[model samples]
Target chain A: MSRVQAIELVYLFCAVCFIVALKGLSSPRSARLGNIIGAVGMTVAVGATFATPGLHRIGLIVVALVIGTAVGVPAARAVKMTAVPQMVAAFNGVGGGAAALVSLAEFDRGHASFGTAAAVLFSTLVGAVSFTGSAITFAKLQELMTGRPIVLPRQREINAALAVTALALVVWGLSDRSVTAAVLLALVAGVLGVLFVLPVGGADVPVVISLLNSFTGLAVAATGAALRTTLLIVAGTLVGASGTLLTRMMSQAMGRPLSSTLFGALTATASAAAAGPDDGADRSVRTGTVDDVAVLLAYAHRVVVVPGYGLAVAQAQHTIRELADLLESRGVEVVYGIHPVAGRMPGHMNVLLAEANVPYEQLREMDDVNPQFPLTDVVLVVGANDVVNPAARDSPGSPIYGMPILNVDEAKAVVFLKRSMRPGFAGIDNALLYDPKTTMLFGDAKDTLTSLVSAVKTA
Target chain B: MTETTLGLFTIFVLSVFVGFEVISKVSSVLHTPLMSGANAIHGVILIGSIVILGTGHGAVQGVLGFVAVVLATVNAVGGFVVTDRMLEMFKGRARK
Candidate 1:
């Protein structure tokens, strides 16, 4: 076969592999194989691209590959699971930056049809937005920037005006093929992306990150259209479609619509109202010792663990697992109640628990475990607040109202391991904390859990 | 639209459907890995960067292409490896 024909065939093969790889990833049992399949496909695609005839500058390609491997491998290998969301955001940002760079370089070569020009501009705009947006998300998750919504006055109006101006520049560049217009469009979109994400509260970041991931995919697909490559278009669209679906699912899990997440500032407004002196602090809370909590767990016939971002932050998954095992040894049944939006990202709590070797069957979704709470004997809520708030169901005036929660208050007794009475990421007080049956054990989650393990062991 | 653009559009639309169908069944427990895995797939843009760099373009384009190649490569490699590391942790009752 000719070189071009051979390259097309390899691309086709790689695309099929990617599809199968995604299919394999639908289940945990097959996910490892799926990852290997994707890696193999990438290797084949890269090798085929390298073999294309008339390809020169081998030294530069080798240098780039060496540098990338030298940096990428260690960064990936060294990242803790709790920071996986940040790592994903950082890697995605670089990918978006790369797409924008590729589009800029292609535009400079300047021999394009209207379709190619429009596609290049589209890629430039979307890629630039995704890059900056993902960077801000990384900063927020890494705690390099405050996770609170950084709202400037009249932010929405400014964002709209900027978007409109960028669109006009794209159209202008399309007609005149002006490089300056294209560059300006990208810069404006980058600023617009920052503005768009800045107003979203930290609790909504997973949804925003997922949306930005889709944007990067669409940007890559646009670059594919500009270059007339089927593989880039297919793979990019696959990620775009999947990422969008995942975003929708995550938002649904939180019981908030995607539109509200991006624009409503719901969490920010609610927390601001709750920040009053009469709010969280004025309420009475019952404090308990580790020995008390230990006795509560040991004597209970059944215990349910509700884990949240705090559990992940404190790196207490292993300690919690040890305590659970101690309980299980005494013939007290134990299961984990996982909120759909728990931790910083979807499925985050499950990953943390899995790292601690918690059985997959023991991790139950909110819907599955909500009805079981009333039958539960003792509910231990670790570093979770908003998801279990009774206000979601009882108080219409509460900000998280109408959002489905874990019904932790229904349990016979509730023990909360927390650092303080401060509100969760949503910045609203949880009525469940003051429930007559609830006892608060205020301290660092890991330290508290460690004490609980020893206490339970002695009991 | 030209035939080439039309063909591209067809591929894009079909790929979207394929993407939705393939990803629809993913369990909630695997959502993060599924996301990171899909994120890695888009790193295919590295091919476009490499193609650009191969043609021996102007100095400016060369510099731009090199950066693109490096960034895309980092994205592709880091994304896949990190995803693999996460999936490896998903082993069953045998692991513990």
Candidate 2:
């Protein structure tokens, strides 16, 4: 085969590697191996591209690659595990920006085939949106900006009108072959991307990040179509598919429709909470200390630990692991009950616990773990609230009603490690907190877990 | 439409199905890694940026190509590294 044919073969090889890599990533046993395979595929594809005969401005390309690696490697390496979501958002944003810029360059290279303008237009707009949208997501996740939803007056109507305007701009760009129109369209879409995510907050932020990741994938695919590059098309489409499926699964896990999740949902639920169940503060809770919780844990035949976002925010994974190990040493069976949306992103709790060296077999998914709650002698809830709240299934007026939650209340006894009496993400009271069988330990999770470990040893 | 466009379109459509099928059954345990891995895969746009830079000319091309290549590199490089970092903890613990 000719050199060009050889390169095409390599691209084909890279595509296959990607498919296998994705397959490896989703299953527990092969996830790490899958990631390594993916990196190899990327290296091979990049190496082949660099070797493309007559590649020009070699110095500049080398410099750009060097600069990017310098910036990207350290940030990825040095980032705290709790901050991986934002780091992913950061990388995703730059990818979108690059795709947008590449397509724009292609358009100016006189490849603005008026016939293929739609494809070009699509890649550019979506790419720009992904870039800007991912930026805001990064900021929110990083706490560089507020995590609360920033709703404007009639944001729905205004965003709808902007959508119409953006569509019109796409039509204009296509018909006139106007780079000017295309550039303008990108600007409007960038604003739309920002406005799009600004009104989504709380647990919804992670879902928005997943959706924007999908947007980036689609943008890259459109870039592929615009440039007629099969590698771009295939790789981009694959990511688009992964992100779309992840977003859907995350929404399903949360038991909310994708649309409402994005557009500042739970307003009705918020109002419902406001109207009546304002009794969380007044009702007395059965508060306890480290010794009480430790004794409860030390003797239990089976204990299930339900970790929440608060456990992550407090960086208490290691502490929790220590506590679990201590319990298991005494012949108690300890397993974690992980809610699907537990740690800001889908499957996040698993990663956090893995960092603490908790074995995957012991980290049970919601469905498999939920049923075991009743058989559990003690349910130790660490920095978690809503996921264990019986109100989701029992209280219709509750904001989180109908949402799937862990059956923590079914255990013979429940112990809560909380920072305060504050309601959970849905902003409603947890009736479970006041249940006669439940006991609350008010403190930071890590500190409380530390105390529990010592208390258990003594008790 | 050109035969080339039609063929590419065919590839694109088939890919969508393949993509969905590959990831649909993934347990929630690997969601983060799958996403991080896929995020890195899309970084293959680095190839597109490079080709554009190698052939295109002028001030506009230079500026756009430079930025595009850099951003794509970060996306690809950072994406893969972070994913590996996440997987490292998983592997390290599992081994012992």
Per-residue alpha-carbon lDDT of candidate 1 for residues A1-459, written as tens digits (9 for 90 to 100): 898999999999999988988888876667879877987888899899998789888889879978887888899999999899889988899999999989988999998789889989999999999999999999999999988667776666787799899979988999998888889999998998898888776767878888988999999999999888899999999989989999987676455678977876533465652354345423556676676577667656789999999999999999999999889887788999999998889999989999999999889999899999989989999999999988889999988899988998989999999999999998998877776578888999999999999977754
Clashes, model 2: 0
Best by DockQ: 2
Residue-wise lDDT of candidate 2 within A337-382, one digit each (tens)? Answer: 9999876777878889999999888899899998898799889888
Candidate 2 yields a Cα-based lDDT of 0.83
**Model 1: per-residue Cα lDDT over B22-87, one tens digit each:** 977554447788888888888999998888888748898889889998999899999999999887
The TM-score values for the models, in the order shown, are 0.70, 0.70
- In terms of lDDT, model 1 sits at 0.86
Consecutive 10-residue window with the lowest summed lDDT within model 1 chain A: A273-282
